[model samples]
Target: MISEKERNVFEGMAIPQILLSYNNGKIKIELVSDSFCNMTEIDRDSIQNNVAELVHPDDLASLSVCFLKFVEEHSNLDVMFRVLDKKRNCYILIHGTGLWQLMEDGTEMILFYFDDTRRIQNSIRHIYSCLKEKDPKAEYNDAVTGLPNLKYMRRFADEKLNSFGACITQQVLIYIGVKSMRSYNDRYGYDKGDALMLLIAKTIKEEFPSSFCGRAVEDHFVIMDEFYGYENVINKINSINQKIKKNAYGITEGIRAGAYVVNPEIKAMNAFDHVRQALKDIGKDMNVICRFYSDERDGELLTERHIIESFEEAMEKKMIRVFYHPIICTKTLKIYAIEALARWIDPLRGMISPGEFIPVLSRYHLLYKLDLYMVEQVCREFEVRKKSGLPLIPVTVNISAQDFDYVDVPEKLRKILEKYGIDSDNIIVEITEQDIAKGTDSFKKQLCSIRENGYRLWIDDFGSGYSSLNVLGQYDIDRIKFDMAFLRHIDDNNGKNRRIMKAIVNMCRELEIHTLAEGVETESQLEFLQEIECELAQGFYFSYPKPIEETKKC
Candidate 1:
């Protein structure tokens, strides 16, 4: 019942509209816009008879509710439904908004229009695309870089190692570390970081197409393959580095690598730890680029892990025993004192060396336990000797820098000595020059407390790193033990070490601090130390580190 002017206004307006006459649940389309009929491809006559015929069967129920709501409220209406365009034989979603109006004859009709739903459908599809599965086979590939993730690579490595048989020993797994990546990420941005990672991944794929490459963790990539040796691995890593530099990410970045040779006898997870060990060995020195695993180092790492895993039980079972290496007095040519060293005598794994377990203890922050254990063993041994009427000598127990972090060193030692009814002077403490070089207040205070309590202190492995005569003026130390490394290279470059050792020993003598030389295996080395006036010495030439029972025989 729209008037002429209103109908003209509706026709001129650019919108798809339809006018319906509603009476008692029956709907009759009275008027339709030309645009609406064109869009739906249905003529006005067909729609005027019954608009319900064009509505999709599934959307009819919802559309009926919308109409009922509009009649009850007598207000605006908005609803979404699908329509079947019979001409095209396709369903088109539509959003309709309208208002209910009363005519002059008291009849009610709904005036409405619809906009296409294609845009909304497109948006929904876009959201779903973001969540599409990256790795359908569950290889756990990273969505951004398209490289296998850590879990997938670990599984792959375990399977490869387990099935490779005798050929496993020849296989090598290499890990590449991007230096200063965290600072780079912070300075530039995450987008650039991700870009660099993608570039690195692409370059790796091109360089080692046959090898299995994966992201082990942030800024670390793992590549597994059979290479000829360390030389071949070095060449390949260098090539990859060159390629990365010349490519897009123009930042000055460097890469270092460590490799592990497959050990068929051990688990793959343990083998991975070996590669990490190599990196730890040389990663700090920028001069080295790549290092390969050695069987000796592998065994040492395994032994260290075994010690850590079993240390507590070993201590309770008395498996960790104290070994003594005699320090000989140069003038008397007799045992003056013994250096107390720890040995893990595992009943199942046999003997584990101090060299193997010491670093592990430091890494796990458990060196304090070992240090305290060593001191207690020394105290008990001295007490037993005194009770048995056996001769007792001062025992030098080495303490680690990490020990200071864990306890009051002076008080702990005092208690242990008191518990065994021994004087502090009976047990001397040896600390490394490197540890002292840190010049920590705690270290200085502990050393002063020990010396004040009448216990002697020795500087072990002196001249090893950053050693100087000025150090003698800084602390009250009793003896300086020359490192074995100095003796190993004594003949290097025509007696360069000989002159250095002589000068060092002379300097210590002038300072009135006693000097000891270790690793004097050959008679020539002994003669040189004796000639140089080293006050005390310990090495295989005197005696190997032996158990308490073996000391009497020596």
Candidate 2:
């Protein structure tokens, strides 16, 4: 009944094809094209009785069910599954379509098989790529959370605002952030971390159905929607906190949310920036759950960005100048030394405060450049002062904790000193107590080496952080500059701060360590510090931080 022409036409097809016949409740391959044999690497004789073995074990049950359904309905069968070849180990992802046919001999057969699985996957990938080009949000979705990623969130915010036909009142962007998720992941496994993230994503999506929710990188989720008023949102956040806390999976630290009410004139990207800025302010305080963006928040990211981008150029142009504040001997009222401070005067932006730009540099790991630049400036300024017939006073330069972490601080400083032909004794290396407390054995050794090289090592901001007194015993520190905060209310002899200050001064005295009081602004503060027998002090009371050029003239 089958014509040679029909058989030849089937064989001429490019795609893999096969015909199956049902006999004794088992499906057997009756007709296979040469293309199918070549693609699967199996000959007609080898596959005749072992057709069932060619199907992947995971896919066999589903394929059998599909065949049964197709037979009963006499409908077309379209299924996507994996099939093994002659190698048995290698599987081909496949898309097969079967059509049931009744031969003239009254026997039933099914015809199916097509191109390999990899081709279909590649085609699908191409389609997704095209979609991503047209709509970027389609491209950068988080696989774990099923939410738009940081990249997509930024573009989506701007586009959504542009498309809004009317102004919506009190629209806000909220950033929900989880703290120490990395530590959590380390304690548990990545699977648990993924599950927790999924749970968090699900909770957020369910809670704020009206909002546009997105994952702004790891452990940071963003929601843009109408503000629920401060009280309502706070209550909602508390509710979320309780839920997450109850199901915390042994995680002690909870989540915090920060909000920024949208300023319609401002770009959506900037508005979300306000949200991130607010989130950073919330920080690690467990008592604080949410914070709103304020205009008073230290610095703007625009200014921060400008500082980072222009830092190298600023240094090259000598726009970043080193100024010194005199630290006088309390007993003699003499200018014993000066602390080198960095001052940035941007040509375009005028004067950018260290308070504004220092943290920016630190966050981006660029603070080391600024610190080293200050060292170079200090060395250069010392020579300039000496050449100008002004006294070359010993200068103390603050080295950031980050510098010691990455670079050889002592080695680098020694090289710079050698380059400038200056004695290490004329330059003091000032590191924070926090730095010394957290430093490793290697860092401690670096501090000792700096000291051995004739550089005086002073612990700056000694009483400010949660540093232990044990640091004084651990490292080779020459002096301890007590934080200004310790002297804030030293005027009150009965106050706890004054008592603690007295105790610290006494403790340092016992260790034969010299103590310098910082921020001695008022007459009363200075008198009290002197009464406590503090060795040296620096403040606006004596003189403000002045450039070497200005000091030379003075």
Candidate 3:
């Protein structure tokens, strides 16, 4: 019942206006935020009208739900739309918020007015840019699935739950990731791999619209959903599995969904982090994928935080000590070498495992400092050995994959060696098998540079994670240290694993590469490895890893 004077008043009010009548589904708008008023040569009124026509098909449902929730919770009637024109000439964002009034007859009428639109287009541009930049080798993202990364997921959850008004720490979460993305990427090119990722993303968004889905790794995706949660999403996932089984790719490609639920007070890495460890609890039973993280386990999370902080402090205070563990020649039964093990004896907590803290250091790019400290420590120790006229046993120190990529690593090693007057053969640099696999060319070049200077290079954890068949050709190295697990598994009569160890050793033998085994804890294991003619070995069976005093006592 807007009179001509009322219409004119609305138009003259100097605001972009829309009057929606509860009576007859009527919508009338006054052109205020138009090209004439824009002062920027933009047709604002047409842009506002076109938003209703060009709402995102993907976002419309969620936007509608958001509006329903918004209206039900509060009377603030503002909304923004990023939409395209009728001809799809250009896109515009319409910021429309509403005002509500209760009439004398107790009828509620809502009126919407346009808000600021300048920043809307910028936000859209940034989002699309992020989606467009494709990185295939990115260890952080599931390259085959466009999902949130572990870093992204953890930070996202931590930030959200850290907020005061947010949900509690016990909300249920589920991590859904693709199984064996590498094989798929290998069988097909990256383009098809990316298509699979898009498929997973779409499937997840279509199935659980409210849940947060993010990629955690090259093959893992994390999902956070409500509880009633497992039942809410599990059935649909099963059907998706069945469909994938029957599809053109057939059963070759499998989608795995793991669920973890937390209490309302639980924080999510955008809801994915809370579920990851929970699902991991039931290790191999892939079918019963849903599990909830217990609240009692806050200790683990707190401990991780403590380790990061304490390790940083310990490094600064030089509380981290390098103790040499002797590596004896099996044939000679004499100490010709040793490994420099980084040990942190915290003031209050005592010894800290390098295993626990090393990953965090790598994650935070703190390995550089640790590497430098190791170099310094080894050099000082080498000087003492020389002055004391002790046997110049070559001391091996680890160099992480990241450090190998550093052009300065070899030079850094050389400086330390020269400064301490340590013989080139007295320092052996050990690079991991994974390091060579990840950075083959750079690693090979770096190792070769160091080796050419009369320094020995050894591949640490040889029969371990991501150990490649072409390791010798992949990187220049003189020796491969067997993983300690090999000894235990072999002793347990672990057939395939034991054979893999033999094959690795045999290959090294043919290449004239020396072989060493770590963690030889038992007599049988040592005798068994020695029977294979292993040249060098280290472990508690021969001699326990000890500090200098402990070594003398032995």
Candidate 4:
């Protein structure tokens, strides 16, 4: 087994690295991991004599001085020089210079390397920079602000695209547009509008700190860089909105963004499609950030646009169907509540998942009608079961973020329930985590009102959205369908991501509200939760989603 100190550098280097120790004139390469040996074409036992043996003849003195300074001064001296390989061929080199103690005896030595060929090409026949130095005149430019234009997005994107060629590391791209800038120009005078644009750019610069704030278009600014991470960017984006409200005056700060991390290894031009997908993800919301532009996001945007034209056919022609997933009483394993999952029975696709069309329904504001129709269908199902001497079990229906605040949702619910002779108590309303996280106070109040009207309010996908604390506490909710992400984490014992999930469940339990874990796929995971004394749960281990009749068979 490799010693601890030696193993650290070799563990994740899928590339190459070496650890060497020297005493007097005697030198030894203590260890070289698989990557390093394969890369260097030299066996460790063969290179154990003089440390200077591997250095190119011309670089030996410079390498020696680099080593001496590291030993004497105890500082980093990152020097890139050429070194000869096993075949005596000189090649690009890199050294990670530091004074490393050997055996804790205070016998320190210089630590450096042979090849540092990973970064940008040497600009001056020396060190490499990550971003290639492109001719300045050739990059993208905005005609309005004289900044790098959208055309240049591809240029800068080239450097940042991930190993997958996807834009990822730069946590995510933030495409910003100051909406109504033209309106400001028209109403408040062009000078005031221009002044506002400059202020907008300045504010983004000051606000984001390290972000590349450039005017990418006439009324838009793009902040490019590793400006944010996947985890915190959503909340940070919200903070920017609040900040604009506090500091921005007549600007109104209507910024819309299409954020994407180019897939590492993906070509630059293709990454632009990801940005466009993000724009569509934000979907007519002028102030929202942290959205993806691909069908990966809410596929419903396109589905909804298509649904708008098809809503008449969908409703009048009887195309929508209700697929029920049993929300079981975990203790008894009895189906206590049935979640009415909306399904689209397109004339062609037969049955389509909610992932296929719900987004489209939400986008076109047709969700109110669709949700009401489901409510009516479910209420009628409840009534039919009651009249036939079957149990009048509760039915849960998912609601849209847009539908929650629409003035007519309550009225429609009341009319549908009353017409079906089903009490409001039989109907439960569930909204997704992302919905409540992104919703306004009115949205929260809208949900609170429905629950107040004797309908239960549930938060679904508990771990997958912002506002975990709120999803468990702040937002008014009756039950939290603990996103299965919590259970999925039990297999990872490193305490990395699972801790966030553990906190959510514990917080929800402490609140004295019901917590239901969704997507329970593994017995060990379920055993893990049971060990934690969690009571409520749902998933394939319990039940999979199916049509009402299909569920009856199961």
Cα-based lDDT for every prediction:
0.80, 0.80, 0.66, 0.63
Superposed by TM-score, candidate 1 places the C-alpha of residue 167 at a distance from the truth, in angstroms, of 13
Candidate 3 lDDT by residue in tens digits, 1-554: 55677656665666655555444544334334332234223455564465445565644665577567655675575454544544546644556667776645676666666644555446755765576575443534543454666666555666544442245433445566666676564333344566776776776677768767776666566655554544556686776655555552423456766565544454454245545665556567756644555555456666667777776688778789888788877777788688898888888878877777787788777787788788888888766666666666678888887876554788888887788777788778887887766776666677778889888888888767676777687556788888887877773654666677777788888988889988877777777677778888798876666665455521
With candidate 4 superimposed using the best TM-score fit, by how many Å does residue 1's alpha carbon deviate from the native?
Answer: 92
- lDDT by residue for model 1 (1-554), tens: 56888667766566789887777876676678877776677787787776788887766876788688887777788776667788888877667888876776787788888776575557755664555544264447764577887878766777866665356346778888877786555334345677878888888888778777888888889887776777788888888888777774547476788888676677778778878878778846877888877888867766777878899998888899999999998778888899999998989988877777777888899999999999999898986666666568899999988888779899999999999898887888999998888857887888788889988989999888767667789888898899998888889999898999899888877888889989888878888888888888889987899888766733
Give candidate 2 regions above 4 Å deviation.
1-168, 175-224, 241-258, 264-281, 293-299, 493-507, 529-532, 552-554
lDDT of 4 by residue, 138-232 (tens): 34544234556666665565664452234334455667666556545433334456566666666676667876556665776666556345556
Candidate 2 per-residue C-alpha lDDT over 1-554 given as tens digits, one digit per residue, 9 for 90 to 100: 45687678766677799877777766776677888877777787776767778777766887788789987787998775666765656776666788977777887788887766566557867886787788755667876787888877666678875543145566777899887786665444355677878878777766788878889878989887777688777777777767776776667376899887776677886777788888888766768898989776635756877888899999999999998999888888888898999999987889899998998898899888899999999998877888888767789999987887789988899899889899998998899887778888877777788889898989998878666988888877789998888777664557888778778889889998889989888888888788889889999999999987788433
RMSD of 2: 14.0
**Candidate 3: lDDT of 320?**
90
TM-score of 3: 0.54
lDDT of 4: 0.63
Hey, what RMSD does candidate 4 come out at? 23.8
Candidates in order, TM-scores: namely 0.65, 0.64, 0.54, 0.47
State which candidate, 1 or 4, has the greater TM-score. 1
Show model 4 residue runs off by greater than 4 Å. 1-305, 386-391, 438-441, 468-476, 493-506
